[model samples]
Target: MILYIKYMVSLRCKMMVEQELKNIGLHYVVVELGSVEILEDITLEQREALKRNLLKSGLELLDDKRSILIEKIKNVIVEMIHYQDELPKTNYSDYIAEKLGYDYTYISNIFSEVKGINIQQFIIHHKIEKVKELLLYGDLNLTEISYKLHYSSVAHLSNQFKKVTGLTPTFYKKLRRKRDDNLENI
Candidate 1:
């Protein structure tokens, strides 16, 4: 049996789902970001109990096919943007379509309809967030960050960063450092 879960994006979420499965005496084959496979089929009663337990921990079990597909799309992008060590070599639309085994047009339409933003916009948002994280870490320079994130150039990165955040990358880094220093002083 396979179960799709919403809001199961982080490692912590995977752990919580695994623990819940154990508590319910269910043996799971694998627990990925947004879905799990169980060794044995589950019962209706078990499903309801599991749903309630997951809800208590801010997760929801997805039953609708459309909702499941949406979650899968989100999980794939989140994993790529936030967790992967290197960006994909191919373009994002092709990557997403190939990964999800659907037509790019269909996926884009569904994602836009459900998320109220185009898939490309969603990817840009996640990429910017990742850039913010790397900048705050202070280990990577703007050039290195751009290269790693597959940007064409540092100028491009700076432009997108400014466009999305209304502040340049250097300014954002300085602001984060200032906030950290203030917290340490207190």
Candidate 2:
């Protein structure tokens, strides 16, 4: 049986889901970001127990088609931005549509209706968040970060960063370092 889960965003959420499945003695074949497949079909009691357990940790099993589709879209973007080292050479809309096996226009319309924002907006948001994380790590300079994140140039990255964060990446990095220094002193 395949079960779709909502709000399974991070590694911690995946771990919690895995632990819950183990606790219930289910032999899961796979547990990816937003879905799981088990070797055995689950009983209603097992399903309810799993749902209840997951709810306690701010996750829910998605049964509705629309919700499941939405989660799949999110999972694809999340996997691309957070997990993959390099983005696709093609346009994101084309990549996403091809990957999901759906028409881009239909996907965009449904996503906008469900999410109250366009898919591009979601991608930009995730990209910005990833940029923030990379900046915090301080392993790469601005130009490298821009290239890694698929930004056209350092200036474009800086403009988007400033537009979203109200501060440049350099300032944001310095602010984080100062805050960490203060915490260490405390």
Candidate 3:
């Protein structure tokens, strides 16, 4: 039996879900970001118990089709940004549409209506977050970050980063370093 879960975006959320499943005496064959496949059919009682347990952790056992599709879209984007080393070579709209098996326009409209953000804006938000992570870790230069994130140029990445955060990537990195240094003195 396959179950869709909402708000299961992070690795911690996955672990919480796995623990909840074990506590409920269910064994899962697969436990990915947004969905789980149980080894055996679950009972109504088990479902209710699982739902209640997941709710306590701010996760929902999804049933609505539109909600499930929305979660799937979010899961796809999250997995691409955080888990994958590289993004799809194709344009994001094509990649998302192909993965979801839906028209890009339809998906975009639905996501905007539900989340109040366009898909492009959503992708930019996540990409900027990834940039911050790389900067914090001091692993990649601006040019490399631009290339890894598929930006047109370092200037473009800088402009977008500044616009989103009101701080240049370089300044952000320095600020984080300063804060870490101050903490070390304590």
Question: RMSDs, each prediction?
Answer: 1.0, 1.0, 1.2
Tens-digit per-residue lDDT, 12-69, candidate 1: 9999999999998899999999999999999898899899999999999999998999
Q: Superposing every Cα of model 1 onto the true structure, what RMSD results?
A: 1.0
| Tens-digit lDDT track of model 3 for 1-186 | 889999999999999999999998999999999999999999999999999999999999998989999999998998888789998899999999999999999999999999999989989999999999988885789999999999999999999999999999999999999999999999
Residues forming the 10-long window of minimal summed lDDT in candidate 3 = 133-142
Q: Order the candidates by TM-score, highest first — what do you get?
A: 1, 2, 3
Candidate 3: give the clashing pairs: none
Candidate ordering by lDDT (highest first): 1, 3, 2
Clashing pairs in 1: none
TM-score of every candidate:
0.96, 0.96, 0.95
Q: Estimate, for each residue in 117-185, the C-alpha lDDT of model 2 and write its tens digit.
A: 999999988998999999997589999999988899999999999988899989999999999999999
Each candidate: how many clashes? 0, 0, 0
- How much is 102 displaced in model 1, in angstroms? 0.7
Q: After superposition, how far is residue 50 of candidate 1 from its true place, in Å?
A: 1.3
Clashes of 3: 0
